[model samples]
Target: MSDPNGPTVRRRRLGGELRRLREHAGHDQAAAAAHLECSTSKISRLETGQGLAKAMEIRSLLDLYGVTDESERAKILKLHKNAAEVGWWEQAEFEEILPSGLGVYVGLEYDARAVQEWGLGFVSGLLQTEEYARAVFASLPLRPQDEIERLVKVRMQRQKRLTQANGPLELWAVIDEPVLRRPIGGPAVMRAQLKALAESAAQQNITVQVYPANKDVHPGLRGSFSLLEFGPADPRIGYVDSPSGNAFLEKDKQVRALVATFDRLRAGALDPEESATLLNTLAAEEN
Candidate 1:
């Protein structure tokens, strides 16, 4: 079952560990579920990080798998307990979709060695200026002012990970030119956003590219997506957000296809230097 509350990074980690253990023991989903006396679907969901695993359930599975090492078993049990802990977003009461998941996403971003993003609509969250983010939030229909403010604040906080003391997170972003020309929040706000984009592009750790409307072909014409490449310990993952909800892709074949599509889109987009010039020209037009 999908957790309506969303899964935490700890939960994701635990799920990964559980998957490794099951594979090491040569137990398929049906075999593991049978050992735990649960539905195979339940084992599948737990391994995929779509649902939480109870401590006792985890313990039972570990025992059934013949895991006799006390240290390893305790470590796995502790991870399960941590996974069940509440995240900071749960305290805010914001109605944003994936509130709990956002915390995990942010944590992943913080640790990721490199991030590649492509957007067909508005700017990616990490690239948006505070003003742009606030305007975006305000445009949401009938949102409470307090809730909107909270969401904007959360977004801004997430951006600090890209600029703070631990050192910049490597970022490469490709956005449709139409996103720049859409005049979100009117001329003044749009101009500011364009300028912000130019400034961000100047940063050594960030690369911003634009795919003009006149481009003959591009893979990202379909929709927005992001590919996050983590350090050695974690696998690369692809994320796509839509009206229904966010989808995370981790299967090797699917992620490889997404990466290939992004590479093609990049090939068709303006190079970083040219993209910066285009942003500056657009900003000048707003003046």
Candidate 2:
């Protein structure tokens, strides 16, 4: 739950700049590593934003890359400094659960100016109520009760971003029809959840659309995916989370594919007003 300019995002921006500089200088990882007296893997990790670069190390890399522009060098150095700051998710409470790429995903979500999500089997996490989220986690066999609570807490905390008045993250969600019909956490929980979802969709920054079950097969049948947008400078990120694994799509081609899929899904889905009406109708049925 880091703020917009979180460390993870800064690391990515800096890493991208470094990679660009190196490529422009015609230096591969091997050459850069030799210049810095570090292993190639270290260079790779920094370029991938998986590892932070120390100021001295960044300076050495800049020097090696033949970066003569003082202002550009200063900007890169500032990125390094900002990326070194500790993120809120690094707190002791989340250490155990965040080892997976969820930490990075959360950071990106916080820093994102907007997000587009397609939910195939369940409601989007950003729209889930506390009880609905708790039930979803508790359903996992043999999961500790404490762990379920922590997961729910993390989900609820993420929703707070939607409520922030200053530049609240714009959310566009496309939900499959079956997801709304499934009585997660029993009918009562779903009833409340649906009502809440409709209210959320009513907000200025949030848009909700439903893909009817009656339609022919669509791209979303492949699975759920999300696109996180950080405006022009940073690359758009495509995200996929499933039981098998989680993937963050950073390459332009991969992100573009996800974008195409989402656009198709949105085209086939109900309009926002109709989606809200359907949610209300379904919620009423649960009573």
Candidate 3:
């Protein structure tokens, strides 16, 4: 019931802890609600992360559960406060332009520690230059002009998660050769995009791999997907998106399969050094 990959991330964690405490106290939902002077449904919503849990209500629950440890109480209160805070994606700036599923994905990506992504058709969003992102958004058959601009803004903003002052997020991206050659936004745009990719590959936190066009068909032919490994502070999430929308895969089994697939793709794709050389050579050809 806890969705750790959305705006309610902290709320989800708080809810889980509240539920755990309730169970440990041997209090049923009805009992806990009676003690808090609220409806059982309210308690249920809070426990499932479908609704926010207030710090006052949390304190009441703690007392009801006989939890005396100050540290535990402090931790739960902090989580409650964080749960109530708004995420960047939830702000009005992107409200209408961002799709719900994609919003949740952005929230998850915001907290990711490392990302392993496979791109079969185009540059992955994080690696795409502003020009490339603009071209990609503009190419959508029926998308409105304003919407394209907003989408581009969202992608560019999302890239910031990789360069934050603290240990930046690690990105391992494998792009199929055809995508690199596809001339997404024309030669000039492609050249700039390739140059940007090479530059990013030079950075310590980013890994760029090109799956050669001449190599035998590989696992990525199935589709594009990303495995987002979250820091210990958050739950790990996997993302898969298509023309319609995006989906999150949080189950251990499903996530493991995606991880294995990525390992195979990495094994099959060019090493970073070779990929850097190829990207540079491709950019030179575009001149």
**Best-performing candidate as measured by TM-score:** 2
TM-score of each: 0.85, 0.90, 0.79
Tens digits of lDDT, candidate 3, 1-287: 12234455666678889999999999999999999888999998798655776678889899999899999999888788778877787788786787656776676677667888999878989999998999998887888988898899899988987777776778999999999988988999999999999999998899999998998767789889998876466656678888777777778898888888899999988999999999999999999
lDDT of 1 by residue, 60-137 (tens): 889877899999999998778767865445454532533535655665565566789998989888899888898888
Backbone clash total, candidate 3: 0
Q: Candidates ranked by TM-score, best first?
A: 2, 1, 3
Model 3 ranges with Cα > 4 A deviation: 1-9, 18-77, 233-235
- lDDT values of the candidates? 0.80, 0.89, 0.84
Best of the candidates, lDDT: 2
N/CA/C clash count, model 2: 0
Instruction: Using lDDT as the measure, name the better of candidate 1 and candidate 3.
Output: 3
| Pairs clashing within candidate 3 | none
